[model samples]
Target: MSLPLMPKATAVWLVENTSLTFEQIADFCGMHALEIQAIADGEVAIGITGLNPIAKSQLTPEEIQRCEADPDTRLKLRPAESHLTRARKGARYTPVSKRNDRPDGIAWLLKNHPEISDAQICKLMGTTRPTIQAIRDKSHWNSANIKPRNPVTLGLCSEADLEKALAVSQPRSSSIFLVRASEASALSQPAAPADTGHYGRTEPQDAHSEAESLFRRPASPAPAESGTETDPDDSADF
Candidate 1:
C-alpha cells in the first residue's frame, strides 16, 4: 500500500471525520491498526492537524464513502494521468531546413483532406494560419512553385500522426457515405431470373407453356398412296 503525504495527518483526518475502521485506515496509511487506534484516541501526535486526502488528490470522496459504507473495503488512491494520456500544449517546432517544406505539406493536406481544419493543419505541419490561408487563396509568394507533397514523405510528421489527424476529421462522413456506396453498388449489378438453363443461362419458362410443350403428341402419318401405287403383276419384255 502507498501512504498518502503526511500519513499521520491524513489518518487523523479520516479518524475524526469518517466512520471508517482502524484497519482500513491502517491499510491505507501503511501504519499498524494499533497506531491508528492511538491516533483516533488522540493519544499520539497531539498537535498534528488533519490533512484532507481529497484536497491532496490522494483519494476521492466516493472512494471514502464506499469504504465507509463497507468496513471491509480499503481506500484506493485516485490514479494520476501519465504524460502519454495528456494532450500537448503550446506551438509545435519545425527545423529550419524543414520550414520551407511546410507549404508543400500544407498544400498536400489542403488538396487531399480539405475537411481538415486550419488548426489541425497547423498542429500537424507546424505552420501558421496565414501561410495556410495564403496557400489556400493562391497568394503565397511561392504559390506557383509549391507542389502538393505528403507531409509524411516530406518528414514533416509521422504516418501515425497524419493518420490520427485524418481520423479526427473523418467521422462525420462515414455512415452516410457507406450507405450510399452500398446502394450504388447494388444498383449497378444486374438481377438474375429464378430459373436458369444449361451453361449458366437464365430464361423465363412459364409452367403452363412448358407442360404443353412436353405433353403434346406428335402428328399422325399423312394419308399414304392416295394418288400413286406400284402394280405387282405388271411385266415388261426385255
Candidate 2:
C-alpha cells in the first residue's frame, strides 16, 4: 500500500492545518499518537519544514475537512496515477554525501536499540547485515571515527520508518520470551501420574514425594567391596 511521503512532515501539516485529533492524524500518517502530540506541542520536529499533503496532491482539502468534522473518522489519501508508477521496489538509494554517515547511523541503532535484530537494522537503514555486524564488532573501517547518530537525523531513513521497524521487531521478541517462559514452567512441573508408573500404569505420586524422589541422594557406599578384614575397633560405635 502507498503511504504518505515524508510522513512526519505530513503529520506536521495535519496538526497545524486542521483540528483533527492526534489519533486521527496519527492513523492517517502512520505515526504514534504521542509523536503527533509532540509535533503539536513543538517538542519534536522543531525545525522540520511541513509538507502539505493537499499541496502535493497526496490528500484533498475535503478529506481533511471530513475527518475534522468527525473525530472518529480517519483521513484517507487521494489516489494518484503517480503512486501506481512508483510501485517498483528495489534497494533504497543513499546520496554520496549521506552514504558516509551510515556507519554512524548503524552504530547508533546498535547502541541504543540492541533489542532490534541485525535483519531489522538492515531493513530500517537500508544497509547490509555484514555492515551492521562490522559496526557491532567495532570492526568497520571507520570504527575509530564512527559516532552514534540517529539515522533519521543523518538522513539515512525517516523516523516513521524507524518506529515501524521497531514496532515489528519488538512484539516478536516479547512473544519469544513468553514462549520460553511457558516452556520453562512446563518443564518445572512434576512428572504426571501416568509418567511415574513402572509398567505404563497410572501410579500417582504426591508433590512432596515426587520432589524428594528427584532430589534423593545415592545409597551409602557398599561395604569396601567385601574387604578381607576390618580392624575390630573400626566397627565399634561411638
Candidate 3:
C-alpha cells in the first residue's frame, strides 16, 4: 500500500497552530497524550521506536519508514517520555526539593552588576521577568540583606560578564570566538564581492511589479483554418 505523507514537523506545527488538545493529537499521531505533552515541554527526547501497540492504528507507512530511515529524524517525530517514567526506568533527575531552589546568585548578579538591568539578567539567566524580579526582591533566597557579592562569586556572571568585558575592552573586531591576534590576521585579508547577477540586485525589488509580471503574460493569437472553410454564419466583417 502507498505510504501517507505525514511528517513530525507538520505534526508539531499542527499542534502549535491548531486548537487540538494533546489527547486528540496523541490519538491522531499514535502516541500517548502524556508523552506528547512531555515532548512539547522538552522534558524528554523522543526516539525512533514506534508508539505503544494501542496507538499503532494511527501510524502511516511513510512515518514508519521515515522513523526507521534516520534515528535523529525519528526522534523529532516521536513523543517525549515522561520524567517520572524516565526516572523510574533508572534515569537520574534532581528531586524538586534538592533542585538549587535558591536565587541568591541571581540577586547577587543584579546588585553587583548594576549596569545590567533586570531584563538583561533574566535573559542571561534563562529565566522569566517575574522570576528575576523575585530574585531581586529576595523572595527566593533572602539576598536583599545578603553581604556584598559579585556575580563571579555566585557563578552567575562568569560567562556573560566575560563577553561583556571583552566587547567593552577590545576594539571593533570580526572574530568573537578566537584571540585578538587571530582576529587581526583574519581582518588583514579582504573578502570577495558577492555575485549579485544570479540573485538580482542587492537593493529591495518592487513587490507589486514582481507580482504583476508573474501573473500577467501576452495573449496568444488564434490559429488559422487550414483546408476547412469557415461557416458563413461564423465569418465576421473586417
Candidate 4:
C-alpha cells in the first residue's frame, strides 16, 4: 500500500501553532496521539509509514534553513551519536547515558541569575554550601556542557515565579547593633559611693548630711538694746 504524503515540519508546526488538539491532529494524520506526541517531544522517528508518508520536499529551502537555525522548531531530532557510538570510536570516554547530564543545582542558579552567590544558591536549592562551591568551581561539574532542567518543565515554578524566588533569595544587607565587651562591662559596673568626711576611710553619707552640705548658712550676731532704753527714759521724764 502506498503511504500518504505529510511533512514532519508541517506536523510539528501544527502541534505548536494550531488550535486543533493533539488527538485531532493525530486523527488527521492517521496516527495515534501518543505517536504524534512522541514526534513533538523528539522521542520518535517521523517518516512515511504504510498509511502515512512525510512530504519533506514540500518545504522550501528557506523554510528548511529556518527550521535548522531554530532548535525549538526542530522536532523528532536527536543527538548526533549515542554513548555506544562514542565507545566504538576507540576513545576512552565515560558513557554520557550513565551520568546525569543535567546541571548541578548551583549551576542552574548561576546560569539563571549571574549575580547569585554560592550561599544563596545553596539555600535556594536546599543543598550544601560545599556542593554549591563545587558546582561553581567547574571541576567536577562542567557548567558549559551541563543542561539544566527547566523549573517550568519540572512544574516546580514558572519563569515569573523563578524571578520572584530569585528576588526573595537575594542577600539583604542588615545593620547589626553590637556592643563591645569593654562597653558592656562599663555599663554593668555599679556607681561609686557618695563622698564622706572621714579621710582615707570613706563612709556612706546620710541624706541629712548631704542636704546640709548642699544648702548651709552662716550664723549672725544679736543686735544691742542700750540706745533704745535710754531714749524711752528721757521721754518719761519730759
Residue ranges of candidate 1 with Cα displaced over 4 Å = 1-87, 172-238
Error of 1 at 196 (Å): 58
> What's model 2's lDDT at 182?
100
RMSD of 2: 13.6
Q: After best superposition, candidate 3 residue 19: deviation in angstroms?
A: 64
Superposed by TM-score, candidate 1 places the C-alpha of residue 18 at a distance from the truth, in angstroms, of: 69
Best by lDDT: 1
Pairs with steric clashes in candidate 2 = none
lDDT of 1 by residue, 50-116 (tens): 7777765778889999998998888987665311233457777788999888899899999998878
* Stretches > 4 Å off in candidate 2: 1-88, 179-238
lDDT of residue 77 for candidate 1: 72
For candidate 2, write residues 60-124 as lDDT tens digits: 87888888888988887777663332422666677898888989999988888877988778777
| Residues forming the 10-long window of minimal summed lDDT in candidate 1 | 79-88
TM for candidate 1 is: 0.37
The digit string of per-residue lDDT tens for model 4 on 1-238 reads 2112333434555565544555655644566789778877867654422211122222344544555465445323222231112112222232354234324434666677765555544434445666556666776546567555443333222234456556765543211113355678889999987765567665536788668866878668787766545677788998
Candidate rank order under lDDT? 1, 2, 4, 3
> What C-alpha lDDT does candidate 3 achieve relative to the native structure?
0.48
Give the poorly placed runs of model 4, Cα more than 4 Å off.
1-105, 141-145, 155-161, 169-238
Score every model by TM-score: 0.37, 0.43, 0.24, 0.28
The count of backbone overlaps in candidate 4 is 2
Q: Give candidate 4's TM-score.
A: 0.28
